[model samples]
Target: MPSLGSFVLTCIIIAISLVLSVSASVGNIKSGPSPRRFMSGSQRHNATFSLTQIRNTKWEPREMSTTAVYAAEFLKHKVQMPKVLRLAWEKLKLHDDQSSNSSIHRRVDGQLVRYSDGQYVFPVTIGTPKQTLNLIFDTASGDFWVWSWLMPMDMLQNRKYYNGSASSDATPWDGQSWGATYAVGSNYGIVWQDIVWIDAIGVAGNPIECSQGVSNWFASLPGVDGVLGLSYAYNDSEKPEPQQTWITYILPLLAAPVFTVSLVHNGIGTIDFGFIDQKKYTGSIVYTPITIIPGGGAFWAFNWTGFAIGSDKYNRTNIQVMTDTGGNISMMPESIANRYYKLVAGSYKQANGAWIFPCKASLPNFVFGVGSSRIVVAGKNFILTNLPDGINCIGGIQSREEDTYVFLSIPFMQSIFVVHDYGKMRMGFANRTWV
Candidate 1:
């Protein structure tokens, strides 16, 4: 439970959300007679938009390796050094430990990798007059910074960068500097009090990180400007005093304290800002509280009763999974990965650490527990892509560096309507039917 002070602070933040009059993205961050009114779709569905409306122009697929995308994502969590290992947990413990490190003011969004564009990318407008740049909607990490005019001209090349000075409404955040150092690259910059807009909905004076210098890893992305971070506040990398992410500022203005991601492969997807879109998901939404762990404040860590492969018996092995959409693949226990591949004939582990199987092999469905619910990842989602030979294909689920930690990504997200409820510190999952 949030302390009285935290609840008060949350209300104040939501009050900010309520005040934003942007009619596009935010809708109306209304306070109903009943706080739970929007919890049910009978009330209103606000700010639901398809990816085609916000995404950058799609590019031809690039030649980067899929596992490289996975490795970059794997290192992201590894660098966080989460100390929680998947272990048995009683429902009583779950009830007690829900939302262990909930963000008081957090925001999230994402982008994808691969030239053929395996990931999703969207455009965001910043500054007074507005400079539009394409960015990844990253829900897991917490630094909402982007490329800026402060970097060397050669570094930016022809890529778009934010000119904060050009925005009449931009103001330098006094004495605040920030950095996001990932395994492959780093983005470091000073803070700005500026408007950050996702489509028509904008957060006024949101904390924006404008990078002075970024590594090749970031610059390599064709049209990406930066990340729109939507994780908890503690995960923010600001020094001295941390600032809220863009989504954090947006969260306060929501009709309900929630956001939903509906990811589809090779097709248009959608993101719901404040209300649940019944049209996107089916069945009852199963809720799971964020797991409790020391030194794991930076993730949406949750525990599952167990998982099963295809029609095989459901293994009630209690394991903790760190759900992140920033990355494109999933990583699980080697034992589990081995068992899964055993069921796929001619599957082999390549020197690159990714599992490959004949593209024609029949892959089984992957299912995991969410309370008593069984959420399934269809067999087709498991095969990442056809290799150059067009014979073998990459498997989406790989072996984790840590035996106890399982990372769930595309295979898990593509077919589900994921409700990230920061207010209550629980994640809700509903089966989604992609149109």
Candidate 2:
């Protein structure tokens, strides 16, 4: 046997190694390729509560600590694209209310609106005393889940967790459980029936997944407590059985069975149910029928007739497109992205796969078609932000060859207003004006 000090030293070495291993694993997720990680697939709207206009629920989005923080934020997007596209080569794939908490948006007209770090969230309250949580309204998925007190200590990042026992209206539901596994890791939880309130009233006996385990990916995002799925078309693949989504419950209660999402760059935005805001956009709304994908599209996927760069005439290059409000940037086929970036002098693809250009490079306007209609995106939006290196800046749009469909996110959305029309099974688009 060895002396006591020698044994203790060996144990310490082993412990340190284990800790570093765990840390490096997480570091890889942050710096490398992982598919679009999802929080909750069951985020649907419920009608039993008062569903009205979301006034001004507010929370900050995840943003870089400083504008010049190199490419950590941009690199993650680049890494996710290849894996996501290779599978689609396989597939694919805000609110306002001013509240004191600043972390959670207060309930309003059934809507939550806040903007930060390029993520849009809505206000949702669960349980009797109304444990409010900030949830991202993701249309690409369908599942409703929130962080729970049951989460492991390490995974809990000082964020809000749903305490089901503290709520008077909480109960077990059908012995069901849900889990969403992602390219990086997985988050799983138990199900409970509780009253969910978005507006003033509450929808009773609604099933919500209380996440007992959270992956480092989801836990790393601040302010985003859960995901509310607006994609009524997609089923919750993680659930033990087919479950009803919140949108299915609330659709019948809507005046026109439609919802609109307006996400403007550097401005207040909202997702309103039942009515459209005419002031948000210019010209009449152009509608395109929802295009079903080859396998299936959980997102509000559609097609555009063509596009034009700067003063160039429109090119009739048709492609399928998907709208993802939670994403910080936009992506397209390498051909189109190359064309767009070429117009910006000094722009070049970086090792991480994102395009970089001089911070002061003149960017050309980008315009894409909505059927016969056309919407112009300002060139400035393409200049995402400056880099820590100081000489260059990252462009908002990136390119990948395997990208089967154009992925539009907050940057593309800043210059346009989008409507997800469930009533007619069509998607609408119109130009947005910041001035």
Q: What is the TM-score of each candidate against the true structure?
A: 0.77, 0.73
Candidate 2 lDDT tens digits, 319-373: 9887765454567788888888888888876433557788888889889998889
Best by lDDT: 1
Q: What stretches of model 1 exceed 4 Å from their correct place?
A: 1-55, 65-67, 79-119, 401-403
Write down the lDDT of every candidate, Cα atoms only.
Answer: 0.60, 0.58
What is the alpha-carbon lDDT of model 2 when measured against the actual structure? 0.58
Output the worst ten-in-a-row residue range by lDDT, candidate 1.
1-10
Tens-digit per-residue lDDT, 327-352, candidate 1: 55677887898889999999987544
Candidate closest to the true structure, highest TM-score:
1
Angstrom error of the Cα, residue 236, model 1: value is: 2.2
| Residue runs of model 2 more than 4 Å from their true location after superposition | 1-120, 153-158, 182-184
